[model samples]
Target: MSQGRTTEGVRDQRAELAEANHVLVDQGILDGFGHVSVRSAEDPDTFLLARNLAPGLVQPEDVQVFTLQGETDDPRKPYLERYIHSEIYRARPDVRAVVHSHSPAVIPFGVSTVPLRPILHMAGFLAPRVPVFEARDTLGSGSDLLVGTAASGAALAEVLGDAAVVLMRGHGFTSVATSIPEVVYRAVYTGVNARVQAEALRLGECTYLSDEEAAATVATNTPQIGRAWQYWRDRTA
Candidate 1:
């Protein structure tokens, strides 16, 4: 793609991602915290992400182009403690998009010794394993040290493995996929799974899906994530 076209593609993805980000914020996924990032269509060395804007109010221009490996060239533009996004993109070539958020329920498993297993059909994606990156010592929310250091961020990426998401201990989550919609899809499921798991713990022993069963279940989730995207377009259009 030409530079302009590539930039346009990133911008387009940014708009779509931002729109989905708006959905997350509206549904209470993010506040001023959290961010959505997509690998730049033009160059892998670059990626697109929201700057200091609220996910609910993101605009095209508000999406910033950033180098995936280092500090941004411009000082005026405040880059997100962006390692969570960049490091994962660098480590997982299969992932084209990522969403990091500070959702409330998801935090329980992130900090607690308890695991956030797949207690619902929507969370079958996490059947194999979900790592609570027990790498942090202290901090508040996703603003933890993972975002501050590239090495820690890479450690965060390693925890994800082939899984769709990873919980940064004492922090939040970093969800990845081949597209913005996929990440958003997983994001919704991530929260839904947490809600179900929390409720299940209270009720009784919740049945968990095995690897094969979970993989098979993923194939059957036809309109799950796609519906999440459309749900936004329909409501926001």
Candidate 2:
């Protein structure tokens, strides 16, 4: 892909980024403190995100562009966890968007040994083992468990490696994808799968999708993400 985009392309991406923030909030994937960002189509070294605001309240003007090094041109401070998006973009060339959420339903699997699995077709992306990033291992025994620094962000990205999602032990989780809509899709379904898996575990054994099943479902569902995206966009609008 080219490292430059037309003015219209940039404007459209900004709107999509803003819409992603609201869609995530509307879906309950993000409450008061989560964030979403998209890599700048005009410049591979930069990405765009809302500045230190609740996802639901983000407006187009609230969006700020930041370098891959996590530096922003705006005088206002960016999100403290902005490094999560920066370092992930630095590490994963194919990833165009990232979402960091303290999704309530997904927290248990992150804090415990229970693995988040693909119990539903919509969340087939979870078939790949979701790696857990323990901040203590990278930041020391007593740390805030926040990927606040470039070093911490890089460490978390290393754990994420090629996976669609990574669980931050005791913190939350990050979802990555090739587009903002796909990342939002993964983030939403991840929470749904977590909730369903928990309920199933309480009842009895839960039969997850097999590897082949997951692959097939992903192939079938990936192209239809526009439907969900449109629904979310309309609902939020």
Candidate 3:
């Protein structure tokens, strides 16, 4: 459905997406539940994500195409939280990839008033403060925390706004970025930063990266993201 998009290019994109799944799982950013997606290279209005399979189990053939509205022609079941990727790509034109994960280290910040801040240069993308999305406000009370509907997903995107990551209350976190590697980088470092921040808090009052420092570090580190990606890819292999 993508005009002038080569079959080989699409195949390569599928392979890259599948590799992302393995990379995230290997980095502990994703488990049996989380997912990652890339905006279709040939079609901005669509994205590519693995089917209902676990991230560590996803292969190129398990990847499927999904519209920004989260529709897909494939009969196989999609992740119920696929809307997390669809609405993010829809809301943020600059974000070409999305990651939704129930990362353990970052879970407490989402539920408590404690804010998740950038404690390390690798996670400078989380500077300022991470916004937390409350599903109850959008879906009413007693709702499952999953972003299953378009409206709920859109609400989460609204909270995500211009930030690199948004935490879901009592759930997990969703990260967005300009590419798959970048989003994976953010997701992984965010968890690490959370763990470090919690330890610092346990000791005493903690210091965090200033906005200017965070910006500067992000500029310095982004180009080297490939190093981390390659290492994770090899580990997964």
- CA lDDT, every model vs. true structure: 0.77, 0.93, 0.91
Task: Please count the clashing residue pairs in each candidate, in the order shown.
Answer: 0, 0, 0
Q: Clashing residue pairs in candidate 1, if any?
A: none
lDDT of 2 by residue, 1-237 (tens): 443547777888889998999999999999899999999988889999999998888888889999999999899878999999999999999999999999889989999878998999998898768899999988999898889999999999999999999999888899999999899999999999999999999999999999889989999999999999999999999
Task: Mark the regions of model 1 whose C-alpha exceeds 4 Å error after superposition.
Answer: 2-4, 137-146, 222-224
- RMSD values for the candidates in order, in angstroms, are 2.8, 1.9, 1.6
Q: How far is candidate 2 from the true structure (C-alpha RMSD, Å)?
A: 1.9
lDDT of 1 by residue, 1-237 (tens): 587886677668777867877877876667877888888767787778877777777876777777767456555555556887888888888888898888888999987777988877777888788877776433344443556677767777787877888987667888888877778778878888998888888887778888787887888884466876788656755
Model 3 segments beyond 4 Å from truth? 1-5
Best lDDT among the predictions, by candidate number: 2
What is the Cα-based lDDT of residue 90 in candidate 3? 88
Better of 2 and 3 by lDDT: 2
The TM-scores of all predictions, comma-separated, are 0.89, 0.96, 0.97
Q: How well does candidate 2 match the true structure in TM-score terms?
A: 0.96
For model 1 the TM-score comes to 0.89
